[model samples]
Target: MVDATIGQGGHSYLFGRALGPQGVVIGFDVDEKAMEKAEERLKTLKCRVILVHSNFSQIADELNNQGIKGADFILADLGVSSPQLGASEFGLSFLEDMPLDMRIDKRIQRSAADIIKYLDEKSLADLIYQYGEDRASRRIARFIVQSRKDFPITTTGRLANVVCRALGNRGKGRSRIHPATRTFQALRIAVNDELENLKALLDSAPEVLKRGGRIAVISFHSLEDRLVKYNFRKNKEENVYEIITKKPLIPTRQEISENRRCRSAKLRIARKISEGD
Candidate 1:
């Protein structure tokens, strides 16, 4: 079993408990703190737990180095974890005032602050449009570029304020989502190189899983859901794997009410259909 992006080990703990003593579970996370938390939680589990501080895109090579050719089951829950959003260091949420650093992996040199300060207006606008899918990307980029001229926009609060100012305050009982939500999400995704990492994972998963092995991915946004959908369809057409979920599965209304973040999540499953050379 493999748990990619094993955030707080919530999913892996359950996977480990079911695996028993004979089963081995390999987990990956970019955040050292998250790995530490996961270790503490999974310490007493019956299965052998191996945790690595790395991105899931490296899963194929990592497994091969450990003398494991293929896994029977693999799972990836993509997106920012709850703790990350609440943590000040990550700067993932605008709900709290924090440094504009969204690098989950501290090793990453370029941060959200760097992007805000360095990126040209057109490039920034393009990034916002492509990643955030926001129609007012140009206006937001203009606001950011103009705001940073007076002083470096180095805090989440300032960035959020700029976005809200550029887009205008529609949050006054008009919309549940904040005006800065999409822009913040775009910055987070860019800082982490999320989409490319996800693509790499998708490209490598089939080869890493054994024939009949199952792979499950839980994505939190439309961009991710679309990528999973099309990739699964392409793989199915090529006879590499069979899609287990015809349509992506979403959280129930009850689940959404209990956990508002789960409202956007979609789960897609697929199984390897052929053996590798």
Candidate 2:
């Protein structure tokens, strides 16, 4: 079993428990802080396991180095983790007043700060609209570019507030969802190259799966879901895999009512084709 995005080892520990002694569990996360926390959490789990500090996008090479031919189960949960969002210097949440840094891995040189500074206004607007699906991307981009004329936009809260001013038209109260949600998402996606990384991960998954092995992906956004959908369909058409979930498995109403974050999550699965079909 491979638990990609093993943030805080929640799912990894579960996999470790499920696998027992007969199976091995491999988990990967790019954040060292998360690695430490997850390692601590999984210390008592009784299973043969290896925790890797690397991006799951490089799973093929990492698994190869670990002498794993292919895993029977692969789980990739694509979204920023709560730890990354809540307890980190790298700003991921608009609610937080922190530096504009949003790189999931500290190794990555580019940051949300760097992206906004370097990317042209057109590119910035496009990024917000495409990745963020932001309705007021143009207004937000214009405001950001103009604001930098006074001083560089350096903090997440400051930027969020700016986006809110530019886009929000309040009668009684603030928006149901913060006006900054889309802007923050756009910045994070650009900082991490998330869409490209997701594409690469999906492209490489089939090759790293043993025959009849299953791969599960949980995507939180439309961009990711579309890529997963297209790639899974393409692979199945090529006879490389079979779609395990004809339709994505969305959270139950009860689950969504309890955890609002899980509302947007779409879980899809596919199995590598058995030898000789």
Candidate 3:
């Protein structure tokens, strides 16, 4: 089994409990802090645990390096973990006003602040539109460009303020969510190269999984969900996989009430198919 996004090893811990001494659970994560915490949490598990401080996109290569030919199960929960979001160093949330550095992996060369400081207005707008699915990307971009001319937008609070000013009063009272949510999400996705990494992981799963092995992905946003959905459908059509969830399984109301962050999660599962099947 593989926990592709083993944030703090919550899922891995539960799965590891069911595995015996011979079973192996390989967990992958880009965040060093997360890996550390996961290592601590999974220490007592009966199964052999191998934690990799790398992105799940490299699963195939990493597994090969470890002499693993194929895995029986892979689970990827794509949502940013709560601890990560709340960590000031990550700058993932606009709600608390942190430095505009959204690199989940410190190895990344550029931060969200660097992107805001350097990217041209048009490209910025396109990135927000493409990644965030926000309709007011142009206006937001214009505001960001214009504001940066006066002073650099160097913090999450300042960026959020700029976005709010761009939308004016509509951003404050009319929306159910904070106005800066989409903009922050756009920056985080860009900084992390999240979508591309997800694509890589999806492409490699079939090759890394044993015949009849299953892969499950939990995506938080529509962009991620769409990619998972289409990829599963394509693999199914090619007879490489059997889609386990015809429609994504969403969290129950009770579950959402317990953990609000999971409200938007969509889970999709697929099983690798043998030629004979």
Candidate 4:
């Protein structure tokens, strides 16, 4: 068993509980804080737990280093942890006035601040347009570049304000979500290389799973869901895997009503087929 994105040990604890005497579950988390908390939480569990402070994209390589060929089950939940958003220093939420630094791993050299400081107006605009699917991306990018010329756009609130101003009044639709929503998502994805890592993980998963092993992925946005859907469908075409969920399984309406953040989550599951099949 593997809990990929073991944020604060919520999923890791669940996996640990399911594991019996013969079961071994390894958890992966990029955040040091998450690892520390998960380690403590699973310490009293009956199952054997080995927590690694690393990206889930490296799960296969990590297991290989330990001479473990494959896993029976894997789960990846792709959403920023609550702590990451709640912390002002993380700059994950535009509501905060903290520095625009959204690095999941402290070791990563590049950051949201670095992209803002270096990317040209058009390049920045394209990133938001392509990655975030924001229609006002150009306006936002132009405003950001212009603002940075006179005063460096350092904080989340400052950037959010600029974006809102560029988009005109906070209309009813705009009020539904924060005006800076797309910009923050774009910056975070760029800072963490989220999509690319997921793609890499999808490409490597089949090789790291035994026959009939399950791979479940929970994605929060369209870009991620698209990648997961495409990979699952593509692998099914090659007869290497079977898609368990033809349509993505989403959270219940009740779940969404209770936790607004889970509203956008889409889960897909696939099982590896026999190599000779």
User: 1-277 in candidate 4: lDDT tens per residue?
Assistant: 8888888888877777777667788888889987888888888788888878888888878888767777888899996987889887677878778888899889999878789889999999999998888988988899999988988887888888888888877423655778888888888888899999899889888988889899999998999999999999999999888999989999999999999989889999999996722
Candidate 2's error at 239, in angstroms?
1.3
lDDT of 1 at 176: 74
lDDT of 3 by residue, 1-277 (tens): 9999999999999999998888999999999999999999999999999999998899999999999988999999996899999999998888888998999999999999999999999999999999888899999999999999999999999999999999898787766889998998998899999999999999999999999899999999999999999999999999999999989999999999999999999999999996432
lDDT of each: 0.91, 0.85, 0.93, 0.86
Per-model TM values vs. the true structure: 0.97, 0.94, 0.97, 0.96
**What C-alpha lDDT, on a 0 to 100 scale, does residue 64 get in candidate 3?**
95
Residue 219 lDDT (model 1): 96
Q: Model 2 scores what on Cα lDDT? A: 0.85
Better of 2 and 4 by lDDT: 4
Estimate the overall C-alpha local distance difference test score of candidate 3.
0.93
How do all the candidates rank in terms of lDDT, highest first? 3, 1, 4, 2
Least lDDT summed over 10 consecutive residues: which range in candidate 1?
168-177
- Residue range with the least summed lDDT across 10 consecutive positions in model 4: 168-177
Estimate, for each residue in 177-243, the C-alpha lDDT of model 2 and write its tens digit.
6778878888888888888888888887887888999999999988899999999999989989899
